[model samples]
Target: MFGRLRAWSRRHSKLVDALVVSPLVLFCLLTLDVYKSGPPFGRYIGIPATLVLSAALITPLLWRRNRPREVFAVVALVCFAQWVADVTLLPADFAVMIAMYGVAARCTARWAVAAGLVAEFGLLLAVLRWDFSQLDAFPSMSVFVIAIWLAGIYANTRRRYVESLVERAERAERERDQQARIAAAAERARIARELHDVVAHNVSVMVVQADGAGFAIDSDPEQARRAVQAISTTGRQALAEMRRLVGVLRQDAAGGEEYAPQPGVAQLGDLVRQVSDSGLPIGFTVSGTPCALPEGEQLAIYRIVQEALTNTLKHGGPGVRAEVDVHYGRGEIVLRVADDGRGASAPWVEGGHGLVGMRERASMYGGTVEAAPRTGGGFQVVARIPVGVAA
Candidate 1:
C-alpha cells in the first residue's frame, strides 16, 4: 500500500507540492503583521504591499521542480527588493531557502552553488540590517539553510545512483535475451543439418532399391523381392529416425517414447553394408586403434561419413565403385570417401548442402573437409578431425 502511494505521489508531484506548500503560504499571509515592527525602518510596508510581495516570493515555488534556478533567482530578487525598501523580514522569506533547496536537488551543481551563495549573501545582509545585536540569529539561520541544501544534494545523489542501478539491470537482461536468441538459432541450424543427412541418405537408398525392383520385377523375381525388402527396411529406418528427431523437439520429456541412441563409429559398418546392398559397391576399411570419443564428436563423425556417401550415391551415376576409409591416430582421426564413376563432373562435388553439412560437422570437432574432383576421375571427400578437441 505504501509503495503504491509513493508511486502515485511521484507521478503527481505538482499536486503533492501544492498540498505541502499551501499551509506554509497561509501561515506566511496570516503572520505578515510581524514585519510591521522590526527592521532599520520604524514601520512596515502597507498590508497590500506586504501581501503582493509575499505572493511573489512564495508562488514561484509551484514551478520550482521544472525551473528551480529561475525560481530561486526570482525569490532572491524579491527578498533583495524588500531589503532595499527597508521592510523587515517576514515568514515568507523562508520561501527563498525552499527555492534554494529545489535548485540544489534538481539543477546542476554550478547552479546550486550559485543559489547557495546568493542565499548566504542575502542572509548576511538581513542579519546586519535587522539582527546585528543578536549574533545567534545569523548562525542559526545559516545552519538551517545549509542543512536544507545538503539534504537536497543527498537526495539528488541517491536518485542518480538508483537510476544507474536500474539501467544496468535492464542492460544485463537485454544481453541475456540476445545470447539466448543466438544459442537458439545455432541449435536450430544443427537440427536442420541432422535432418538433411538422415533423410537424404535413407531416401536415396530407398530410391535405388525401388528402381532396381522395377527393372527386375519379371525376369529376376527373386532379385526384385530382395529389392522390395531393402526398400521396406530403408523406409522403416527413415521413419524411426524421423520419430527420434521429432521426440527431441518435444517440450516435455515424456511427450515421446524412448528411441535408440544416435549412430556413431560403431554403426558405420552397418551403414556401409546397407548402402552396398542397394547396388553401389563400397569398400570399407578402418586403420589404427579406435579410442572412445565424446558423444557430440562421435555424432559429428557419423554424420560426415553419411553425408559423403549420400553425395556419391546421388551423383556417382551407374555401376560406381566407392571406398570408405577411417584412420584413427593418436592425436586425430581422418575420414575419406572416394568414388570412381562416370559422373565425376556432377555439381554435388562443387556445391550442395550435403558437402556444406559435412564441413559444418567436421568444423564442430576442430576438423576440416576437402571435397573435389580427383585429377584422373571421380570425386573425393576427405575430413581430418583433431582428437581430444573440445568444440
Candidate 2:
C-alpha cells in the first residue's frame, strides 16, 4: 500500500504538494487574529495585506520541484516584505524554510549554498523584527535551517546514485540481449550448412541412380529395378534429414513433433555404407579409442565427412576409390577423407560452401580443416578437433 502511494505521489506531485500545504494554509486563515494590534506601537497590517503576502510566500511552493531556485527567491522576497511591514505569519516563515529545502534538494550545490545563506540572513532579520524577548529562538531556528539543508543535499546525492545504478543495469541488459541475437544468428547459419550438406549428398546419389535406371530400363530389367529402389531410398533419407533441420526451428512451439537425433560419430559407419551402396567404392576405418563428444562438435565432424564425400562423388569421376579414416588420439580426434580420383583437374571451385562449411564447422569447435589436392593423386580433407580425454 505504501509503495502504491509513493508511485501515485510521483505521478501527481503537484497534488501531493497541495495536500501537504493545506494544513499550513488553514493555520494562516485561522490566525488572522494574531495580527490584531492597535496603532502607534503595533502597526496593524490589515487582514487583506496579511492574506495576500501569505499567499505569495506559500503558493509558489506548488511549483518548487520544477523551478526550485525561482521559487526560493520569490518566497524569500515575500518573507523580507512581511518582516518590513511588521506583520509576521508563522506559516509564512515555515514556507520560506520549505522553499529553501526544495532548492537544496533539486538545485546544484552552488545554488543550494546561496539559498542556505539567504535563508540564514532571513532568520536574523526575523529574530530582530519579532522576538526581542526570546533571543534563544534564533539559534534553534538556524539549526533547523542547517538540518533541512543537509537533509536535502543527502537526498539529492542518494537520488543520483540510484539513477546511475538503474542506468548501469539497463546497459548490461541491452548487451546481454545483443549477445543472444548474435548467437541465434550463428546457430541459424550452422543449421543452414547442415541442410545443404544433407540435401546435396542425398540428391546427388538419387540423380546418379535415376540416370543409371534410364540407361538400363530396356537392356537389363533387374539393374533398372535396383536403381529405382535406390532412388526411393535416397528420397526417404533426404526427407528425414530435412525434417531434422526444420525441427530446430519449431522446437519452441507447443506440441512439436519429436525429431530424429542428430547424426554423430556412431552414425558415420551407416553413412559410409549408404554411400557405398550408391555404387561408390568407399573404405571406412576407425582407429584408437572413440570418446564422447559434444553434440555440436559431433555434428560438425559428421557434416565435414559428408561434404567431403559429396565433393568426391561429384568430381572424383569414374573408377574412383574413396576412404574415410577417423583416429582418436589422447585429447583430439582426427578425420581424413581422401579419394584417388581426378584431383586438381576436377572442377571443385574454391570458396564454395562445400569446403568452406567444413572449415566453419571445425573452427566453431576450436578445430581446423584442410582440403586440397593430394600429392600425386586425388583430393583429401583433414580435420582435427581437440576433445577431453575419455574417462
Candidate 3:
C-alpha cells in the first residue's frame, strides 16, 4: 500500500504536495492562537500573527521545490520570525528542516552547511533567552538538531547516486549509436569495392572488342561479326553480375535470393582471352602444378588479376607488352602482371580506385600486392595469396 502511494505521489507530485501542505498550514494557523494565548506576553497577538505570516510565506515553496536556494531563503526567513516570536513556535519549524535537505541535495554543499549553522545557533539563542530551565527540553531539542544535520548528509549522498546512474545510462546509449554507425560505414565500403572491380574489368573488355570490330569491319567481314558477338556477350554477362551485386542494397527479404555465383580462379583462362582480344600484346604463363582452392581465395585471386590488367590497359601506352604469370604451389599461389610501357612520370604518384580494389581483395585472402615501376622499364604488379591457412 505504501509503495503504491509513493508511486502515485511521484506521478502527481504537484497534487500530492498541495493536498499535504494546504491542510497542515490551516491546522498550524488554528493552533497558533492557543500556543500564544498563555504566553509571558499574555494575549500578545504578535505570536498568532507571525504564525499566519509564516504559513503564507511557505505556501509559495511548494511550487518552487526544484529551486532549492529560493525555497531555503524563504523558509529561513520564516524560521527567524518564529524564533523571535517564541520558543513555542519551534514545532512549526519543520519547514526549515525540509528546505535544508533540499538545499543539500540540489544546491552547493556550502549553502547546506550555512543554513544548518544558522538554524541551530538561532534555536539555541531562543531557548536561552526564554530562560526555560527544563532539562527534558534539551534532549529533545538536541535530537531535532541532529536529525536535521543527518537529513542534509543523506540528501547529498542520494543526489550523488542519482547523478551517477544518469551518467552511466547516457554513456551506454552513446556507445550503442557509435557501433551502429561503424557497421553501416563498413558495409558501404564493401559495396563500393565490389562495384569498382566489376565495372573496371567488364568495361576494359568491351572497349577492346569494339575496337577490334571497327578495324575488322572493312578488311574481314567474318572477323568483324565475331568481335561484335563477343562484345554483346561480355556486355550481357556484366549486366547480370551488376544486377546481382546491386541487389545487396535492397531491403526486401526476398531479394536476398538473387545472388549469383561470383567468378573465381576457374575463370582465369576466360579473363586472359578477354584481355588478349583487347588488342594489347599479352602473354599468360602458368608455373607449378594446379590445385583447388577455397571459393573466397579463388575469387580474391580473380579480382586481383582483373584489377591489374585493367590498370595496364588504361595506363600502359600503345604497343605495350603485358605478361600475366600465375604460380600455383603447395601452400600459396603467386600472381604477377607486368607491362613494358611508358612509365608514369611521377613514380610515386598515388593510385586510383583500381589499385585500392586490388589491395583490398589481396588483403581479404591474407595476401599482399606490390605495384611499382620496374628497374629496367614500365610497371609491375605482384600479388601473393596464402592457401589452406587456418581461418
Best by TM-score: 1
Model 2 per-residue lDDT tens digits across residues 177-252: 9999999999899788988998899998887788879999999989999999989998998999898788778857
Candidate 3 lDDT over residue span 1-391, tens digit each: 9768867977887787677567557766676666544665212446656566666556755854567778878877766765575434533566776676667666667877787776677667666766467645766786787687777778788868877987998999998999999988877887787788888778887887788799899999899898888888878888888888788777874833756798888898888888787677778899998887878778878888888888777777678889999998777889999999866642334667778778887887788898888887788999987776532
Q: Taking the tens digit of each residue's C-alpha lDDT, what string does model 1 give over 1-391?
A: 9769988988998998888789878997688666555544434777898888789988899988788888888999999988887776777889998999998888788888888889888989988877778868898889988998898888778878888998999999999999999998988898899889989999999999999999999999999999999999999999888888877778886844678799999999999999999999999999999988888888999898888888888888998999999999878999999999744577554567888888888887789999888878898889999986433
lDDT of 2 at 90: 57
Per-residue lDDT value at 230 in model 2 = 89
What local lDDT does model 3 show for residue 224?
Answer: 88
Model 2 pairs whose backbones collide: none
Error of 3 at 390 (Å): 10
Stretches off by above 4 angstroms in model 1 are 1-3, 37-43, 83-86, 128-140, 252-256, 342-344, 349-351, 389-391
Predict model 2's lDDT versus the native: 0.86
For candidate 2, report its TM-score: 0.80
Candidate structures ordered by lDDT, highest first: 1, 2, 3
- For model 1, the run of ten residues with the poorest summed lDDT: 34-43
Query: Would you list the C-alpha lDDT of every candidate in the order shown?
Result: 0.87, 0.86, 0.75
Q: What's model 3's lDDT at 71?
A: 80
Worst 10 residues of 2 by lDDT: 35-44
Q: Tell me which of candidates 1 and 2 scores higher on TM-score.
A: 1
